[model samples]
Target: MGLIKTVGLTKTYNGTNAVDGIDLSIKEGVCTALLGPNGAGKTTTLNMLTGLINATSGTISFDDRYMGDRRKYIGYLPQYPKFYGWMTGEEYIIFSGQLAGLTKKEALSRSDELLSLVGLSEDKKKRVSGYSGGMKQRLGIAQSLIHSPKLLILDEPVSALDPIGRREVLELMKTLKEKTSILFSTHVLHDAEEICEEIFIIKKGKLIIEGDLVELQRKYQKPTIYLNTEEPIEDWSTTIKQKEWLRHMDVKKNKITVTVEDMDMAREALLTDESLRKLKINSFEVAKTTLEDLFMEVTGK
Candidate 1:
């Protein structure tokens, strides 16, 4: 069995189905990205998987045991966590470790180590009330790791951070991968493309696509050719239309963009076209589609 599995998971709120028959499997030792737009049921799904909210129907299993029986092995970071405002970061981590059933000595040692790991060792004694949002997030991550759980679930962990803070958190997450499997939910496509080994793209609470990065890129990458000519290429569109390999062509200023079925054929044609040589083409390049483009294409936004 995979480290985490949700089978036919469904959640409904006041007669509205928020999560509808979603199934997912996350293997151990890899980071998986749960991607969706707002109100896509990502939060609800995470809650159900963690047993914070019971699913309306379906089952979640971890390591062959049901979710309820596997709580000790899972560590969760909610979207907006609430911590005692007066408690220092170190104290809070100790409390979390104790709650997770660690002994006092173990809790203290783990708290210190985790605080340092998340880059909060210097501010370990600072009250949470004085902590910034990013700092609080780092604390939350440290708290979640206190017990050394097998699976870590982070809900929009880097969403509220600045670029530098986000980079720090991403690096921390990468560092933690050796000890824990991560299931991270976020609307940020670039983050997923950067760190996640596998991804599940959901729209309106339904699983639209799930796969490794390379396969997802291959499936959604748009076939487009870019050409820059010495002068304005108004006739280039009409000329490309005559070629059987060309699907469509668009001309903008001195550049002509073409879409074709096969990029190799398009590249060969562009390189070998004698007429284009005579016209003094300045540059010819193919534009590969990105994760952002794939998200927009799949979600139609």
Candidate 2:
């Protein structure tokens, strides 16, 4: 029994299923990433999970330990979180706490603790409109956690930020995970790879793949060769595209990446090939598949 489990969870809009029958087991105290491309139903699934919308069918079951209103046990941050820009950071959190049913004293105490947790204690008095993009997001996180929910759900937590803001929110998430369970949706494969212990990948409103991050990487591992040459290898690449061991090949101006079924055979064949030897090779290296590769493969992108 994980922290939350869904059985044939689904949602339909005008007879079209935005989220098809999908089953998920989100573990307690672990960081999980819900991943997919645009219009792949990531948001719809999160909406259903957070109870923002009613599902057309299926069941969402929390662990037996958590009883009563599902909202009480879950905290959420939307992709585009809105805050009262006129309110100071501290005031906003305290307001959110009160909205979640805390007393004035309790909200005040929690606001102080959460302000420090998100690293905004010094700037807590500053209006949200004056804060940076990263600061706003950190504040949104604090507001979400004010009620002390067991699971935190964020929809595209870092998608709209600049590089610095993205890094800031990502670092905060890494720290927050140590204190509570997290489920976030993201299209950025690198960010998901950075923090998530488990991943669920969806495509076309369907659950395509779900598993432990390390285990999925190991399972999809493939032999690949990367080649950089002083000159373009376009002509030469086309000749070997039909090789028995070649699974896939991507050719750029002066670089070629080849995915192969057999590393031993690919190494021997490429090293000794007449056309390949003719080029002034800068570097040739063999490597394993990455999470990006897995995403590309599963999503057929």
Name the lDDT value of residue 167 in candidate 2: 95
Cα distance off (Å), candidate 1, residue 163: 0.8
The 10-residue segment of model 2 with minimum total lDDT is: 292-301
1-301 in candidate 1: lDDT tens per residue? 8898989899988898899889999989899999998889999999998889999998888886534477778889999889999999999999988988899999999998999999999999999999987888889999988767889999999998898779888998989887799999999898998888899998887899998977888877778888888877886556777777887676887888776888888889888878787778888888865678669767775
TM-score, candidate number 2: 0.93
lDDT of 2: 0.93
Instruction: Report every candidate's CA lDDT.
Output: 0.87, 0.93
Error of 1 at 149 (Å): 0.9
Global local distance difference test of model 1: 0.87
> What TM-score does model 1 achieve against the real structure?
0.84
Clashes of each: 0, 0
lDDT of 2 by residue, 1-301 (tens): 9898999999999899989999999999899999999888999999999999988999998888999878888999998999899999999999999999999999999999999999999999999999999999999999999988899999999999999999999999999999899999998888889999999999978999999999988988888999999878999999997889999999998999999998999999989987887888999999997878879878875
